[model samples]
Target: MIAAVRVRGRTGVKKGIQDTMSMLKLTRINHLVLLHEDPTYKGMLVKAKDYITWGEIDEETITQIITKRGKLSGNVNVTEEYIKENTDFSSIEELAKAVVAGEATVEDAGIKPVFRLHPPRKGYEATKQSFKEGGSLGNRGNINELVAKMI
Candidate 1:
């Protein structure tokens, strides 16, 4: 007689943290930072080992996330204002440009990964009707021509 027991547990479930990272469907986890205008803005950069949301680096979001997670190490202003404080970023495009140049962190620094959306492969030409219907002397012609090149 053979008897066996299977054991499984919630070993992989991460607790109490979520962000835009999940939207990325990331193949790899890399660093993300929020930049600032003044050299002083770098002070608010929050480091996350996992995914994070689309929060402005100017204030609050970083503070709350970093404070709650305790995964990042650095000083935070502890203020509860982001959108209001970051009013300068009028549009998502403006926000993105700043992030690219490293002038802001979505607040102080604009550091984010470059996302290039690539189109998927068109897939194989699954049907062979074109080859088959090359008119009249088709099927044998394909085999004979291939062999003729050898001769």
Candidate 2:
């Protein structure tokens, strides 16, 4: 799965970009969404590249995010028991693996689709520039480090 994090706020953003970010479910800074790496999602990522950072995520990082930040309805934390009771997975690790493999989704695992992450521990770099330019925006290649800091 591809992980996308909104790094910038909505101030002075174009309405069309805001709408695209909304469609991606990245409505706030530090919010995260896992999406399939398909053409449609890729297009949306490109469209909102100026305000968000995205990259391929691994199973280990995904598991950590789910364990630490994944939430259920009514603000409950996700646990192995919850996964067993509400979904086919026996553990969060398994669910994360399934998600990374495109065999399952956060919703299918009974977790909220959006992950409300803490801002990175040390804060972001230049939010107005791309990752290639040593800033926090645009595709990040491997997003594990950034996600780790936030988690």
Candidate 3:
């Protein structure tokens, strides 16, 4: 059920990239699960930073977003037991592969589950106008204005 989630928040662990975390609760996924042939992975509650404390899902999602092979993937496992057991695997891909190879259980993927994330359904980005501000900055006043103008 590999579905891309629209990330939310901008204050989590940072790597070379993953600049910002998702900040809104806006997610529109029209599709359900894709091919459920694979085992379903769950999520573990990590800390949250930027907003309140620290520890968020941004890092995991960003890592998984990479499509190129060899690139580390996001952690899809979310079992407390697994996390309690192993505290290694610097990358999500390593954890994922571990799960595939039966070395680790789905719960032991290290990364949180995927369902909690916003799915990638390609929805229009919200603008200031939507928030009662101006449009975009391209003559519309703000980015939204420019978008509406272009449309």
Highest lDDT, which number? 2
Q: Write one digit per residue (lDDT tens) for candidate 1, span 10-59.
A: 23424422222232222232222233334232221112122221222323
Q: Ranking by lDDT, best first?
A: 2, 3, 1
Q: Measured by TM-score, how close is model 1 to the native structure?
A: 0.20
Better of 1 and 2 by TM-score: 2
Model 1 lowest lDDT segment of ten:
1-10
- Superposed model 1: Cα runs more than 4 Å off: 1-85, 107-151
Candidate 3 lDDT at 37 equals 20
Per-residue lDDT value at 5 in model 3: 26
Model 3: what TM-score?
Answer: 0.25
Backbone clashes in model 2, listed as residue pairs:
none
Candidate 3, residues 1-151, lDDT tens digits: the string is 2222222333344532232212212122211111112322111111111111111122233234321111113533334344346656644555555543446533344333323322223433442222223221011112212111121
lDDT of 3: 0.27
Q: Which candidate has the highest TM-score of all? A: 2
Evaluate residue 2 in candidate 1 and report its C-alpha lDDT on the 0 to 100 scale.
Answer: 8
Q: What is the lDDT of candidate 1?
A: 0.27
**What's the lDDT for residue 61 in model 1?**
28
Backbone N/Cα/C clashes per model: 18, 0, 24
Give the runs in model 3 whose Cα sits over 4 Å from its true position: 1-86, 109-111, 123-151
